[model samples]
Target: MSIHSYQTALVTGASSGIGAACVRMLSRHDMRVTAMDRDSDRLAELASETGCEAIVMDIRQTEELYETFADRDIDVLVNNAGLAHGLAEGFLGTGNDQVDEMIGVNVTAAIHVLRAVLPSMITRKRGHIIAMGSIASLYPLGLPVYGASKGAIRSLSRHLRMELSGTKIRHTEICPGRTETGFFDTAFGDPQQRASFVSEIRLLDPADIADAIEYALRTPLHVNVSSIEITPVDQVPGGQILG
Candidate 1:
């Protein structure tokens, strides 16, 4: 697709991190983006920097998602909002609250958002949906909920593509390995753990993932890149814990 082929895009989690990166990259291509996130200030900052519209939204609230996108014509929908909480205490030790939160945000919320936007895309016969899954999706990790949530997204991406087979809509799943982000510190809840986990390899900059997103969106309308797995050159393909 040409840089200007897509006039507008809707990106969830478009405040900081990967979502913010995507907004910045897409704006450079001159696409009008509807950037939404829970962080109103950061979302505003992103919009100001990218010349895109910003809306403060929490995807966990399915009704709010519908209200936000009801009247919009979206050319691309990037489902990128998600979270991970370590279940180091064992399955029950992980606690039901954390599990519910992950499922609500990663799996349930994604379906609601997709359902709300897909009809318009189908009616218009033009759109692309990209989900930000993780390398953990390919194989289960010790963090059961985190891996399973992403696993759901990975499968959702494929099934969506199959369902939209003959339509102009396209679905792409991006599975990126560990990166230098607040995710490690926040998820693990230990600064020391963050260092231990990430010290093995250089991290991929958020801009790199953003570039991949832009590329997938910019691919010619006829050529749909269904899936992408990107990691640092030093990063292994699977099981980051392997010796």
Candidate 2:
């Protein structure tokens, strides 16, 4: 898909997985891409491979984040940096630090980045904001905290779209089901546990979601795709409630 409409884009969590895929796809479309991630090495590699600018910094660092993109005239903002402790851990089991980290990165960080970039878009009166949500947010899930974070994203996207009504700016939420990424490593820690959890379920690749983002961005300025939920063909959410 051609992103000729957009001249520049900023993608968070761009070192790997869906974020990295977005960097590659946007670059292919000839958009000037700014890839951001905490991993300096991986960010450099991605920049080299895709010919995009790299910002090696944690999204949680609000001050630095603002400074990094101060002079950038971004046309698209992809909020994709997020993490979870594990499905087995309930809200209390996850502890304070992990909970803070999840909220900080998933919700707060996105807000900060938007705050920095939206002014430019509003001034230009044209831009697209793509947020990465999860199917877990759509239904009651075992991963309570993670689901809540994504749910916040859903609400944020909806409200932002409403606030930007009658303007050229657009907001879209891409909610994806199980995707193969390092998320499992951070959540489960042990390799065996991660394998066992995903062993039975069909996992979607990062590229799949990246393709969805491309489609959303490629749509005409008059067309706004509000939200899209994508899941692996073999995996479906169960509706039964266990007592």
Candidate 3:
């Protein structure tokens, strides 16, 4: 099956990595893609490359989101903007400022993005919301704050599907593990630190994630792939857990 009806899509954090890959993939499917990100240069480059409308702004500023989507009829909303900080320091050791930033972008901004875009979907009675979640949300590990933020997304995706029941709208969370993206650069600021962590397991590509999202979007309307938990084969969960 294919999504032949959706004419437009809005992807957050769309300047690079998985976001950019999603934009490219959606464009291939003949959608007028809107790429939103804080990186003006990269956004402009992407717009030039794919003819997508690029909106440059900090998603954390919730107020601007209201103005940005005021009149746009977005058929698909890729709620993909997020970041991780202070991996070097555990929760208590991590600075409160870093903690707040994580929550601001990953949680607060994600909600506002949905709030800003979902109205149009509700009015039209059709839409698809794709959330970018992480393995951290499902498993326990070194990132407590980061994991907490993603866990909130996990809950949000479920509740959103519940809320949209009986409608044509669909909500799916893509939980990816060890993907090679700018995420590693932000999470493990130090090159060596990121290398050290990924040394044990092979990493998945950003395109791999975009492929999972494509699968979710292309499914028949009657079928809602609520959540997709994808990870590298070598990178299994901790002992005694099949998840």
Candidate 4:
């Protein structure tokens, strides 16, 4: 679909997967896109391929993040930078470092990005904010820390909907289940383990998740598509829990 509303966009964790797909989609529709990620090589490759402005930096660097976007009036903010670690180990069994990394990148840095862009959006009185979330956040699952991080996203989206009431700004959270991305690689940290985990189901593609984001952005200016949870038909996320 062609985009008529948004002019400039910033997508975080944009070197690959859902983030990269989003950059491609937005750039395809002629939106000026800024793709940010710590992977300089991949980020440059994507920029070369898509002609998107690439900012190579770790999302955890709060000072640099704020400075880089100070002059940008981003129409669409994709707060998609996130990761999961020690998922197979679960929370209690996971390393403290893994816990910190997940929270730092997913929740803390996301807020910083939002703070940096929102002041301008508030002044302009228009913008669309999209937070990358997961189905794990909405239900009981094996992931404790990772799920908690995304759950915070779920709450943030709700609050944005409440706080941005008449500012003409929009908040939408895209929650996808089992997408084929480097996310699994980072989450499992082992190729064989990651493969086995995903082998049973037909995983959703990064572009499929991007399609959901596009749909939300394509809606009428007055219509705010609050949240979308897209999953592969083969993937179901529930089981009985009785004490």
Candidate 5:
């Protein structure tokens, strides 16, 4: 029995990394895809390569989100666009703009997109929401604001599942750890730091997270994979010790 039931999927941050991988994977499954990203050039390139509908717009612009998805009927929504501006000194160390940007893109924008897309799904009673979370959400790593944003996603996914319990709608949180997506390049200010971190450990690829998402989505309608926390085999958290 085949469980590939979705017809259309919308993936945010689809220009690169996990989002791009999801676009490609979903397309390979014969699902129509709408790829959204702020990077117009990369979005166009991805669309050309994968035959997806590309939308060039920043997710932080909430007003535009409603207008962009006004009439689209999306079966799967992958909230993958997020940013972590340097983890130098946690939340208090960063400027207000950086904090706002992280919260806006990582948390608020997802809610806006959900508001815009959920009505049709609720009306039809069939949809799946995939939230891109991080291991930081579960295991704190000095980046307070980034962790908080992902924790918000983790909480949102849990509550959303409860809110839509009787309906056919499903929610999943994909929490990935230390992915080799060049995300650390933006998260760390020093090039040497990024290089050193990359060399120090084996990181999970974006495709790994995308594969997990694909599996969750392709499950039978009766089965709901609520959450998946994936990390490289080489990486594991140690127990906290009392000093």
Candidate 6:
């Protein structure tokens, strides 16, 4: 999808996965991109390849998030930095550290980004805010923390949309299920189990999710697509949870 003229897009988790894909696609559409991630090296690499600016900052730090976006004029804000499996197990197993980290990054960090970028957008009367959520939000499962986090995201997206009504600021949430990303391996304690859980499902590609982000941003100015859920056909599981 083609972006508006002279729009700047800020994508969190931009070093890789869905974030990176969004950055690349936005850049291709001639939108200036500020790619933010905790990994400096990977952020730089993505920047070089996509011709975007890279900001190395952990989302957990609110100050860093504000400082990173302080001087920039952003037209689109993609809150895409979050993980679930490890955090889920930790919450279930009573691991406080992991639980805190998960809440910090997935929920707290998103608020920080919104606070950092939203003021200018609302004042200027032009901007699009998108958050990456998951299907876990819709149906409750064993991963209480993760499901809760995504549920918060879903509410946040809808609330923001209503709050921004009668204004140019738009909000949308994209809920994707079972994407084929390194997250399953590197971010989880039992990569095999995680893989096995989704083995029979057709997973999404980073670009697929990215395309959804772009589409949400490119919708007609008068029309706001508040929520979009995307999942692979095989992962539908006959409208039931995978066994």
Clashes of each: 3, 0, 0, 0, 0, 0
**CA deviation > 4 Å runs, candidate 2:** 1-4, 240-243
lDDT of each candidate versus the true structure: 0.82, 0.87, 0.89, 0.90, 0.86, 0.81
lDDT top scorer: 4
100: Cα error in model 3, Å: 0.7
Per-residue C-alpha lDDT of model 1 across residues 111-159, encoded as one tens digit per residue? 9989988888999898999999998887556677888999999988888
Deviation (Å) of 156 in candidate 2: 0.9
- TM-score of every candidate: 0.93, 0.95, 0.95, 0.96, 0.95, 0.93
lDDT of 5 by residue, 115-158 (tens): 99998899889999999998889886777889999999999988
- Determine which window of 10 residues in candidate 2 has minimal summed lDDT: 234-243
Q: Can you write out model 2's per-residue Cα lDDT over 121-215, one digit (the tens) per residue?
A: 88889889999999878877688889899999999988888889877898899999889888888888567878887776678899999999988
RMSD from true fold, candidate 1: 2.0
Every model: Cα RMSD to truth: 2.0, 1.9, 1.9, 2.1, 2.3, 2.0
Local accuracy of candidate 3 as per-residue lDDT tens digits, 1-243: 138489999999999999999999999888999999999999999999999999999998788899989899999889999999877656777778889999999999999999999989999988999999999999996789999999999999888888898778988999998887888778776788878876766788889999999999988888889999999888787894432
Provide the lDDT at 58 for model 3: 96
Kindly provide the TM-score of model 2 when superposed on the true structure, using C-alpha atoms: 0.95
Candidate 4: misplaced stretches above 4 Å? 239-243
Ten consecutive residues with minimal summed lDDT in candidate 3?
Answer: 234-243
